[model samples]
Target: MSLSAITLLGAAGEAPTLTVVGEGVVLVPADVVYVSITATVQDENLTVASSESSEALNRTIEALIEAGVDEGAFTAGRGRSVSTIQTASRVCNNSTCVVVSDGAVNLVREEVTIRFDAREEALINRSFEVARSEGAEAGIAGYALVDRRAAIAEAREKAIQNAEAEAGALASAAGLKLGERLEIFERSSPLIREPSYAFDPLGMRMTDLFDLSWPVAVDPFETASSAEPGMMEVISQVFVTYRVSP
Candidate 1:
């Protein structure tokens, strides 16, 4: 991407101005991992469905706490309930007609988000295992860096240095001495790319039962252990204008 800026020196005076855009990038390993666990229950009775779903969610939370996850690092979202209806279809005279069937069920679902230290692989694995054993579906959500502000600051400084170096080089090549800095503008900041778990389905039953909305070619659970930590890049850009001395 390009950074652009405009500057006028001394109210349109005849002094030459140099404007340059510089970019900086840094790559870092993620320090934290996030996982979202969802528990679902369906029954003909709404009360039973809601109760079972809540119980399952509570068990999952307890299991995560037992697996050494800090309670503060996890959050439970509001529970959702929906009424699902079953329909029967009949084709007669090259036309299809649908009729509502007696088969109707209430579904209740609750979700919990857990944050784990990336370095603690054992605890992370155990947390997933316990959640799954407690009738919850678990999957990797994303990853994050611990010191994001520091990384961004470093990248921004590098961008400033790069702009200065380019400006000086251009001035020297043109037989002109670099003068005072006129203006500095931060065009962009570093961006962190979160890992996607949209395509990963841990178990076959999860794939078969849930409305994942996409097809999974591989089992995420079988390959998650071998998967490497998430990688992210920080990028910064700045536009600078400087005065020129003849």
Candidate 2:
């Protein structure tokens, strides 16, 4: 049920007033998406590990550019390390499997990541496909809105308008003339059902990709990763109080 109230708030400090809450919603397409491709290698020799990782990383970048993604869109990835080195320990017993010695690193692992922004749906799908084919793990970082402030402002205006209209209807229903707005309050927030892959850093949802009515990749010639763009939802709520004329 909607929240509403009639209280004693008047010109003489004791008259009837009507209060109501209103909400506004706005839907906007996703303007950009964050994509990450990481090439990882593990070997007993550090040089070999590092060299192979760089090769895989380079292949990923070349494939993305060849697939039509802008080279300038790429950025240094933020994760483990650009040149991170870790150590491996020796296990003493098979049953216990305890670290017997903290000796020199028996194995070395290297990870190189590259991140970029994709504006077009086809490019985003292509980026994922090409990166994965090049022996790199690919994933979506998150969805973003370039015009976030504008969308919020429009939703707020609609909320205020809706509050006024509802307040007027309530006052007239109680056999009183709608006078003037006594008070207005706003504590609204934008709400969206964004997935937690960016939050968890492991997986993403197809909800954004399939939620919209973009064409499914059924054609043999259609280059795609079987995904599409998603939308963002913005909402604002407002409370308004109006004094009634007897």
Candidate 3:
């Protein structure tokens, strides 16, 4: 059919609120992966601990970059903090004043973060393995895909198409031809859920009490293949006003 001919049949004088629901669905492969990891250090002396922590974190960051992570993925902490070891004081009921004994505190923990964007799913899987093996000591916080706008849009169209199909079916069953829609509206946002991260306790742990240093490794495996794909769904509704033949 000619474009003009089709448009002429569906033209509206004012704002046309055709209550005809249409649904459509489209599936697109996940295009990005994100990794979150933290580097931590600990020691008996705050100064010494801070220094060692900084050094270790620097090494970890260097390792990630050397392993192909970009500089943009590396993020370090603001400052060093002296974490105090505190014990609750006890008061004794006596005629004399009780001696207050506050114990000395000695300990420091330094932390840094590392992240990367994965364009290739397999590459992402490989990066996970590299992070754990080389620099990840405390292990990865988790991983995820960002910006799902495109997937949602696809699902929304599918949902609208589904609604339209239902409306047409009902009209056909009643021996009536579907007519102009008076109003159409989206019911809700499309749902898109995807699995982002998985953990293997055996692959991650903590060590080096003085430095609070540890090594982390991620298995190079096809996460997408191993895991089930998340669902994307859409929903919409439309109202139509048709003139029935007497």
**Of the candidates shown, which would achieve the greatest TM-score relative to the real structure?**
1
- Per-residue C-alpha lDDT of model 1 across residues 1-246, encoded as one tens digit per residue: 233334344445579788877666566678888888889998989889888988888888888897788888885555465767565555455566555455677778878788888888898888889988988988887777877887788878887888888888888888878888888777434554443334445533342345332122133452222224486556677778899877
Weakest lDDT window of 10 consecutive positions for candidate 1? 211-220
Off by over 4 Å in 2: 1-8, 11-16, 44-51, 81-119, 165-177, 182-229
lDDT of 2 by residue, 1-246 (tens): 123444555566676777777666666766767777777776656677767777777778888899987877776543433344455576766577664443333232233333334357677788889988888888776666766888888877887787777777777777778877888777535444332323222222454354332112121232222223466656666777877777
Clashes of each: 0, 0, 29
Each model's Cα RMSD: 10.2, 11.0, 13.8
**Which residue pairs does candidate 1 place in steric collision?**
none
Model 3 per-residue lDDT tens digits across residues 28-103 = 4444434454344554466776776667656666776676766776565534456666544656786655656666
Off by over 4 Å in 1: 5-14, 76-85, 91-102, 161-182, 187-229
- The residue-level lDDT of candidate 3 at 103 comes to 65
lDDT of 1: 0.71
TM-score of each model, in listed order:
0.68, 0.59, 0.48
Q: Residue 125 error for model 1, in Å?
A: 1.5
